[model samples]
Target chain A: MNLAFAEIQETIRMVQMESLDIRTVTMGINLRDCADSDFEKMNTRVFEKITSYAAKLKETAEQVEKEYGIPIINKRISITPIAEILGNATVEQAVELAKTLDRAAKELGVDFIGGYSALVHKGITKGDQTLLDALPEALSTTERVCASISVATTRTGINMDAVRQMGEIIKKASELTKDRNGIACAKLVVFCNPVEDNPFMAGAFHGSGEGEAVINVGVSGPGVVLNALKRHPDADLGQVADVIKKTAFKITRAGELLGRIVAERLEVPFGIMDLSLAPTNAMNDSVAEILEEIGLERVGTHGTIAALALMNDAVKKGGAMASSYVGGLSGAFIPVSEDNGMIRGIMDDALTLSKLEAMTCVCSVGLDMIALTGEVSAATLSAMIADEAAIGMINKKTTAVRVIPVPGKKEGEMVEFGGLLGRAPVMGVNPFSSDRFVSRGGRIPAPLQSLIN
Target chain B: MSQKRAVVSVIGKDQVGIIAKVTTILADNHINVLDISQTILQDFFTMMMLVDVSELEDLEELQTAFDKVSNELGLKINIQLEEIFQSMHRV
Candidate 1:
């Protein structure tokens, strides 16, 4: 509070200019009430609950912004899993529900809507089974519809049975809507210990225990933090970390203020401020930029793991200082299309799925925003998912896979999503096969009680 | 109304009456101290406070008020935007 040193207004201006503003303020709405045995009642009730609950989300976020002068970018809503609501309903009914939610989001003017999902982490319950079966048609037909399947867990291990099922599921999902650039699967995610209240998606869904309404804000500034680090190139690790810790603190503050404001206006409980550096297609703030600052020219390399570990730790450390509740996968995201620098790394042949997976072990979300070739087998895709789930289960972190199998395209080809669904140059897959392993069509026994160590 | 908390750190030589003088200024301005801690390393004295001033307009007001305390106590003071304070809970 030394007024003589620098004006408080100057400090505020410094924070405003240096920090990246919030990426999104998401209201996680539990749609358990949407469940109904009757198909039509289920659909109508489902539509009404989500549409009404989220209608004010974006507007309220904007209001909070103008009132506080803190910019909260996206106003999104994540609902309960679609399969849970589609009880006793046909797959067509599920697809119809998907369309209804999509229309609701469109009406609300939200950039994206999450929660067209199913979770099979422990085991695929009847509801999860139905959701799995309904995903292909539901995703193919609906534009804003996103889907997720968690067929593995730390306690229950990998569901080879569900994995085999999803292998076929993903193939059908890809083949059915190749024209939408196989965009349906792109909106889908595969997860482990998937948080119900996650504000980011195509995998966001209100957890079973979440309040009827809760607001979570995801504050991202990997690009901003990366830029700050760039300013101190030759500094030692401690100094660089000091810079990151400080940047995360300011960003989290902005997000905390926004979350409280949005939740108050929406009349929902403010959940927590997620300090995840949710990278976008923006140039300077991408995860690749952060990695580049860590001495790697690209994200896929030998030192990538160390760079990611340092970044993930520093973000959590810094963000933790700024909020009472800092949750979600609070680390760097290496999504392909959504991050322009990551996309460039892919196009330049400097990035690959293996390296992405390796980096995910040290990150919050594993192998997200990745695009695969259309020719991949459901079995191989399942194997790829199994690979990621293994990492998540072992690390006990929230990890997800959002793969876009660009329809009718081969590896090395790039497909343009047009709009925020940015373009991706299809990545090559490992030639080696996992058919025998994946086709076992049963659960892999849980890992040792003690870690592999 | 939005309220921001700051962790004010006073680091300098460990001299007599450091706490007595700093507390006087804060109390004079009616800025209630939510929490405080002190530590000594070698001849240096470090004191930190978690103070809430939703009652005040801006940090400048707090800084202007704290200058009287800092000058008399000969302490280097930093008002950290307390959201940046180390998280007490671990995940």
Candidate 2:
């Protein structure tokens, strides 16, 4: 046999017991050529383009899952930002385009379709403004469409105007879907320095720089990492880091193999593999659990940031070694709702918004999947975006805020978002107002770090 | 066509005619067994077989056949592509 018996058993154990699986195999289809002056014509082109490219996506993924005996959780499609294809189109047309995307997603049998998005990190164009205005209605009416907006980047300072508008848009989206515990807001993400080829949602989008179409895979295995750490209960921190690196290398190699096969079958170019430790609501499958295993009393305690920083760096090192192309927020994710350990930390009062914000400075994403009180003002939400954007801008990293302000829900109350989104307790925000700060709506002026060139 | 292979592993308690039952199914499907290794660890029967699946038409069909035998013998039988193990364990 080419492989050792122990290695085969270990692989089986990871799949059967440790919840190891490829998170997503997202196909990025460029819709730039789908733009047309006529509203109906553009929508028709958009629908046809997406459906034709993604017709075999789910079937191919299912075949690979069976052949390899490794589950590929989500087979999704991301396209060119709709705002780019909505040249001079009306807000109603933008909403119509979103409906076309949603209809195509349903026809293709995929769960979620991302890239109902706009990039206005520098300034909002007419088309971008149209997409922003249509977000609430677009999100409310659609089932599988996910939206993302980039309001800041390192080179371009924060667009306070877009941030404030997104705050209002999020509130309205929640109000529109208040019957479902504000579920529409869960499908939306506000990003600072968002990546173009991210295979994760609700932030995945086929960026402008990408080619016609490509396949990107996101690998997840927090449970595998946790199990590896449990074997060495008494190992020092350095040894602990080495264990995580080795485990991550194996996970990334498996992901690359699966991704390359999928891309080859689909006849699309293989883009990148995202080695993200994305956690799930399942027990022991959490980045927070990994942190706790690293000698922390809980995930959001005093030493949480240091533990996350070390783990994040080690994961990157291992993944970079395993694959030549590693991109798309390749670090540990700490979404409160999606992670059982994070939810427990929040319930136990060990984790708070402040700690999550602080931890994002050392991790991949920022302030993800947190539900806040209904009374939380839009200015406060904008202020939160500003804070997270500042962290990303200063550190030259990707940060995002996907907060749901559930209508009629108070602090300490819980909102259930069902599958994947899970449930989140409504957290209390600072009572102090950012009304004046956000009201002075202009550019925040790119920091001195932007002048590095 | 180039050669393609897979690893079929069966793990459970040692049972009568376990090897015969599995190899019969492989031979029925025209899958040639290239290598076989079997052991008993702590009163559990574990077997690993490398087979040339290049002549096999559908992997799922063979899996369903194995599923029936697996249920009859009360063993966990899984067949996976050789590439998965090679990619993870090597380099």
Query: What are the candidates' C-alpha RMSDs?
Result: 9.7, 1.5
User: What i-RMS does each candidate reach, in Å?
Assistant: 9.8, 0.8
Highest DockQ scorer: 2
DockQ of 2: 0.80
**Candidate 2's residue-wise lDDT over B1-91, tens digit each?**
9889999999899989999999999999889999999899998998999999997766999999999999998998999998999999898
Off by over 4 Å in 2: A450-453
Q: Positional deviation of A452 in candidate 2, in angstroms?
A: 10
lDDT of 2 by residue, A1-453 (tens): 768988888888899889999999999999999888888999999999999998999999899988998999999999999999899899998998899899999999998999999999999999999999999999999999999999999889899999999889998999999999888998899999999999999999999999999999999999999999999999999999999999999999999999999999999999999999999998889999999999988889999999999999999999999999999889988898999899989999999999999999999898889999989888999999999999999889999999999889999998899999999989999999999999999999888964555
Q: Which ten residues in a row have the lowest lDDT in candidate 2 chain A?
A: A444-453
Q: How much lDDT does each candidate structure score?
A: 0.75, 0.93
DockQ of 1: 0.03
Candidate 1 lDDT score relative to the true structure: 0.75
Candidate 1: CAPRI quality band: incorrect
